[model samples]
Target: MDNAGSNQDKGNGKYAGKFPKIAQQTRLLNILVIFAVIYTLYLAKSLLVPLFFSAFVALLLSPLVAFARKLFIPRTLSAGALIVLLVAPFTFLGIELAEPAERWMQSLPKIAAEISKEIEEISSNIDAYATPPAEPVEKERSFFSWFGDDEKSPELSPPQDNTNSVTDKIKQSGIDIGLTLFGNAPFLLAQVLACIVLIFFLLVFGPNLFNVFVRDFPIVTNKRRTLVLVDQIQRELSSYIVTISIINSCLGLATAGVFYYLGIDDALLWGALVALMNFVPYLGGVASCVVLLVVGLVQFGLTSSAFLPAGLFLVLNIIESQLITPAVLGRSMQLNPLIIIIWIAITGWLWGVVGVLLAVPILMCFKIILENLGVFDHWIRLLESK
Candidate 1:
C-alpha cells in the first residue's frame, strides 16, 4: 500500500509539472480560436448578416407561427403569410415616405449651401472685429540675385477652371456610384430573397430542427440540457424582441407628435427614421440627435429655437433609455453598459452596420448559453449590469 501510494504521488507530481505548460497551450489555443472565429465572421458577413437577421426574425415570428399551426393552419403557409405580413409595413412605409424622402434629398444641396453661407457670415463677422496681421513687405530682387535664384524658377502655368473641374468630378462620382449600385443590385436582391426564404424555413421547421439537433447529442444529459437551453433562448429572445418593438413603436409615435407640434415638415418620416435608428443603442441615439439638429438648423436657421427639436428629442431619449427601457426590459434583460458598448464596437468593426444591429441580440444569446452551461459565472456577472 505504501509503494502504491508512492507511485500515485509520483504520477501526480509528473502531471503537476506539465500542468502549467498544458494550461498555457490551452489559453493560446483559445485565443487563436477566437481570432479565427472573428476572421471567419468578417469574411462570411455577406452570407451571415442575412442569416443572423433571418434568425432573429424567425425567433420573433415563431411563436405566432406555432399558434397559427395549433389552429390547423399549415406551417408552410403560415410561415409564408407571416413573412409577407412582416414585410408589408416596411413596404407601405417606403411608399408613403418616398415623395417626402425624395424632396428632402433634392433640397440637401440647398441646405448645405445655406449652412455654408451662415458659416461664412459668422467667420466674416469674426474677422471684421479681429485685428489683421500685418503683411510682410517683399524685397525687390536683381536679375543677378544669387540668393533668390530667379532663373531656376519654372514658368507659371495658366490658371485652371476649378468650377469645371469640380463639376466634372461630381459627374464622375455620380456615374461611379450609379455603376456600383447597378453592379450590386442583383446581389442585394438575392440576399434579400435568401433572407426571406431562410426566415420562412426557420419559422416552419425551427422547433423540429432544434429537436433533431438535441436528439443528435451523444449523451442524454447533453440532449436535455440543449433542449432547455434552446427553449429558454427562444422564449427570452421572443419576449425581448416583441417588447422592444412595441416600445420603439410608441417612441416613434411620440417623436412624430413632437415634430408635428414643432411644425417640422416630414414629421412622420423623421419619426420613422428615428425609430429605425433607435435599434442601435448609443450610436442610434446620437444619429437621431444629429438628424434632428440638421433638420432644425435647416428649418429654423442658426437661432436658439433651432435647437428645440434636438433638445426635446434628447430629453425624450434620455427618459426612454433610462426609465422606460429598463422598466420594460426588466433586470433579467439588463446588460453591463460597458460590455454593451465594447460588444457593439467589436461587432461594428467586424460586420459594419449589420454587426452593430446584431450585437445586443448575439450578446444576449451568449449570456444565456453561458448561464445555462453553469460555467463562466464571473464572466456572466461581468456581462450583467449592476
Candidate 2:
C-alpha cells in the first residue's frame, strides 16, 4: 500500500512537471498557426483584396439600401442604384481632373528645370556663407608621368552613331507605356467588375446571408448573440463610414476654397486628392502636404509664397484630424494611437496601400467583435481609453 501510494504520488509529480511544457508547446503552436495564416493572406491578396474591398463598400452602403427598401423599392434595384450613385461622382471627378493632370504631366520637365535652378542657386549661396575656403596645394609629377610621351592621349568621346533619334526614343517610350497599360488593364478591369458584382449581391442578399450564417451556429443562444453582433457591427461601421465621408468632404471643400483663394492651379484636383488621401490616416496628411509643397515650389519658385499652400494644408489637416474627427467620431470610436499605428504598419505590409487605407476600419470591426464576445476584455480595454 505504501509502495502504491508512492507510485501514485510519483505519477502526480511527473504530470505536474509536464503540464507547463505542454502549455508552452500549445502556445508556440498557436503562434505558428497565426503566422502561417498571415503568410497565406499575404500570398492570396490578389484573390482576397477585391473581396475585402467589396465587403467594406457593401457594409458602408447597406444602411442606405435598407432605407431605400423601407420605401418599397426592391433590394436589387436599390443596391444597383446606390452603386451607380456612388460611382458617378467619382467618374465625374476623374473626368474633370484628367485634363489638368495631363497638363501637369506635360509641364513636369519645365517645372523640374526651374526647381533645379533654384536649388543650385540656394546651394551656391549656402556654400558661399557656410563653407570655409580650403588652402591650395602644389602637386608634384610622378616618375611615370615624366617618362610618358609629351603629347596628351586622345580624349575619349561617346560614339555619335550610338545616340538615339528623338522620334525613335519617343516611339519606344510610347510602346513601353502602351504595353504596360495593355498588360495591367485587363486585370484591373476584372477586379473592378468583380467588386461591383460582389457588392451588389452582398447588398441585395446580406440579411439573408446573415440569417443563414447564424442558423449554422447549432445553439439558440449563440445564434442570437451572432445576430446581435452582426447588427451592431453593421450599424457601427456604417455610421463610421458616413461620418468620416462627410468630414472628409468638408475638408476637401475647405482645402479647395483655400487653394482657390491662394490662386493655385487645379484647386479641385488638389482638394479631391487630399480628400481621397485623408482616408489613409497619418501618411495621407503628409503626402498631401508634400504634394502641395512640390506644386508650390514648381509654381512660385523659392519665394515665401511657395510655402503658403503647404502651410495652409498642414494647418487644415491638423484641425481636421485633431478637432473635427474627434468631435464627429466622439470617444466611443477612439482607439490607442500606438495600436492604430502598429495595425497600419502590419496591414500595410500585408496588403500595401489598400491595407493602409482599410486598417482602421478593420481594426474597429475586430475590436467590436471581440469586445462583444467578452474575450480578451483586458486587452480591448487597454486598446481604448473609454
Candidate 3:
C-alpha cells in the first residue's frame, strides 16, 4: 500500500511539473500562430484589401438589391444594375472634375511659387518684429583679400526669380506623381474590375452562400447562433453605412455651397474630398482642415480670408461629428472614441488610407459579432459607453 501510494504521489508530482511547461508551449504556439497570420495578411493585402472592400460595399448595397428583388427582378440583374447605378455617378463626377483637376495640376507650379513667396514675406515680417537689430562689428579682412592681387568674396545675389526653383521642384513632383499613377493604372483597373465582379456575385448569391455556411456547422444551436449573429451584423452594418452615406452626401452638398458662397475654387472637388474624408473619424476632419488651409493660403495669402474656409470646415465637421452622427447613430451603435482612434491607427498602419476609412465599420461588425457570441462582452462594454 505504501509503495502504491508513493508511486501515485510521484506520478502526480511529475504531471504537475510538466503542466507549466505544457502551458508555456501552448502560449508560445499561440503567439507564433498569431504572428504567422499577421505576416500572411500583410503578404496578401493587395488581393485581400479589395475583397474586404467589396464585401463591405455589398453589405451596403444589399438593401437596394433586396428592393429590386421585391420588384420581381432576378438577383443577377438586380446586382448588376445596382453596381452600375452606384458606380455611374462617381464615373460622371470624375469625368466632370477631370478638366478642372488637370487645370489645378498645371497651375501647381504657380501656386507653389506664390505660397513660397507669401511664406517668405510672412517670415520676414515676423523677423522684423520678433528679432532685435544686430550690433555692427568691424570685420578683419583676410591677408589674401588685403593683397594687391585682391581676392574678393563672391557677393551672393538674391534670386531674381524665386519661382524657377519652386516651379522646377513642382514639375519634378508632378512627373513623379504622373509616373506613379501611370504605373499603377492597370493594376488599379484590374482590382476595381475584380471588386465589381465580387460585389455582384456577393449581392446575388449572398443568402445561398450564407445558408451553405450555416449548414456546415453540425450542431443546430451553433447554426442558429451563426444565423442570428450574421443577421445582426448585416442589420447593424447596413444601417450604419446607409445612414452615414446619406449624412455625408448632405454634408458634402452643404460644404460645396459654403465654398461656392466663399468663392473658393473647385468647390465641388473640395466638397467631394470632405465627404470622402468624413468617412474616417477624427483624423479625417484634421486632414480636410489641412487641405483647406493650404488651399486658403495659396488662394488668399496671409489675410483673415485665408483662414475662413478652414475655420468654416472645422465648425461644420465638429457639428456633424458631435451632433449629427450621435443623433442619427444613437447610443447603441456609438463607440468609445479612444478605441476608435486606436483601431484607426492600427488599420492605417496595416492598410493605409482605405484601412483607416474601413476601421470603424469593421470594428463595429466585430463588436456586434462578439457581443452576440457572449465572447468578449466585457470588451464590447469597455469599448462602447452606451
lDDT of 1 by residue, 287-372 (tens): 99998998889888879988987888898889999999999888888898778889899999988877888898899888877877
Q: Decide which is better by TM-score, 1 or 3.
A: 3
For model 1, state the Cα shift of residue 372 in Å: 3.2
Cα RMSD for candidate 3?
Answer: 4.5
**Per-model TM-score on C-alpha atoms:** 0.82, 0.83, 0.84
Off by over 4 Å in 2: 1-4, 106-114, 124-189, 216-221
Sorted by TM-score (best first), the order is 3, 2, 1
After superposing all C-alphas onto the true structure, candidate 1 shows an RMSD in angstroms of: 5.7
**Model 2 accuracy (lDDT, Cα):** 0.83
Give RMSD (Å) of candidate 2 vs. truth.
6.1
How many Å off is the CA of 293 in candidate 1?
A: 0.3
Q: lDDT per residue, candidate 2, 1-386, as tens digits?
A: 99999999999998998899999999999999999999998999888888889999999998888898899999999999999998898889889998987677556555655655565666668877986665443345677877777756544443234232443444455456546655876888888889899999999998787787678756556677677778888888888878888888999999999999878988998999899889878878988998899888877877898888889989999999999899889887888887888888999899877788889889888888887778998878888953
- For every candidate in turn, the CA RMSD to the true structure comes to 5.7, 6.1, 4.5
Specify the highest-TM-score model's number: 3
Q: Give per-residue lDDT, candidate 2, residue 59.
A: 90
- TM-score of model 1 (CA atoms): 0.82
Instruction: Indicate the worst ten consecutive residues by lDDT in candidate 2.
Output: 155-164
Local distance difference test, per candidate? 0.82, 0.83, 0.83
